[model samples]
Target: MLLKDHVVLITGAGSGLGLGVAQYCKAQGAAVIVTDIATDKIQSLASEFDEQDLLLSCDVTKIADLERCKDAIVQKYARLDAVIGAQGVFDGNLPIQGMSTQHLDQLFDELFNINVKGYLLTAHIFADLLKQSQGALVLTTSTAAYAADGGGAVYTATKGAIRSLIQQLAFEFAPEIRVNGVAPAAIGNSQLKGPKALNLDHQKQSDIPKDAFLNLFQSISLLQELPNAEDYGALYAFLASKQNKVMTGQTLVADQGLLNRAVLTQSH
Candidate 1:
């Protein structure tokens, strides 16, 4: 019951890590507002939610869609206790040299608009509602924010920018609302997709063979096991809970010792 009686709104909750977070929060007694760019995707999970919960179609990059979502949440619940900015796009690790000039601009815009600007807009539009409830904002970052090879230049830059946003927004919203982040490495069964501009919109990380995915992580992580998207749920819950009053402006890394290994190996 970590989130009992809490009302949380999550973006990209149609699949992957966001879906895991939504389910976990609901199981802990929270009323979840799940949103995704694809209406059908959100509708597919309708059976799992009660009437008290909400499922809406939201394109995180659009202010009009966000404003509509905000209005719906306020009308239904009267207040919001937590907001999770989980929408993101990958770069498929496309090397800088490989990208044509035209594709590079589109790729950068696609990734930043969704990954960084989306979170910025979410926080901006919802700041007042969150403040009214003295709530928390939990954002998703990645190990790529701190290390190389997790993504290509564009993806890494966007994640790094998120880390800065977490700190900056936390400072700006302090004493009224708390802000924090979770930085996870690769999830074995994640449905995370790449930008359409890169022709990877249909690509899902989960589509990779299970053994191959596990082997890929096992090669880099000290733990030698791939983490599941569900593994990150509790961390989000903890950060969103009212009981977690002292923590803010920080990102909890859940990379299974990958960063540690990178640091140690580099010291040689």
Candidate 2:
């Protein structure tokens, strides 16, 4: 009940880490507003929430759509306690050499629009509301932000931009709104999709071979196990709660000790 009576807005809440945070926040007594591009993905899960917990169809890249979501939240709750930007698309690890120039351009636009610009727009649209309540902002970044091979160059760059955004915005919004991020690696059974420009929009991380994916994690992670979407929810919840008073402009890396293993092996 750390978030009791809090009003939280979350993007990409239909699946993956976003959905998990929405559920956890709701369970902690927050009025969660869940937004996703795929309405059908959230329909089955809708019954579990109360009527006050809204599930809206939102395209994160569209400013109007985000504005509409903001308006709805204002109309209902009149205040926002937290904003979680979780809408993102992967690159399927397409190497730069493998992509044509035109394909690379399209991929850049698609990924940046959703992964980087989308987070910016969410903060922009909700800034006034958040300031009114002195709310917290938690953005979803990736382990790819710091490590190579987590994704291709483009995906890595976009996540890096997100990490930068969190720090810069924290400095700007401090004393009124706090900003932070969660960077997760190899979330098991994630429904993360790739950009359509690369013809990977239909691709789901869950579609990959489970055993092979697990094996890949085992090869790199000191924990030797993939973290689940729910494993990340508590981090988001804590970042969005009053409990995180002294932290901002920082990212919590939840990568199953992958970075530690990488450094250790390199030293050996």
lDDT string, candidate 1, 1-268, tens digits: 9999999999989999999889999998899999999998988998989999999999999999999999999999999999988889999988989989999999999899999999999999999999999999999999999989999999999999999999999999998999999999978689999889989999988888998888878777888767677778999998998989889999999988888775446431
Q: Which 10 consecutive residues of model 1 have the lowest summed lDDT?
A: 259-268
Best by TM-score: 1
lDDT, candidate 2, 60-142, per-residue tens: 88899988898888888888999988889999998989999999999999999999998998888898888888889999999
Residue 80 alpha-carbon offset, candidate 2, angstroms? 0.8
List the candidate 1 regions with Cα displacement exceeding 4 Å: 262-268
Error of 1 at 73 (Å): 0.7
TM-score per prediction, in order, is: 0.97, 0.96
Error of 2 at 118 (Å): 0.4
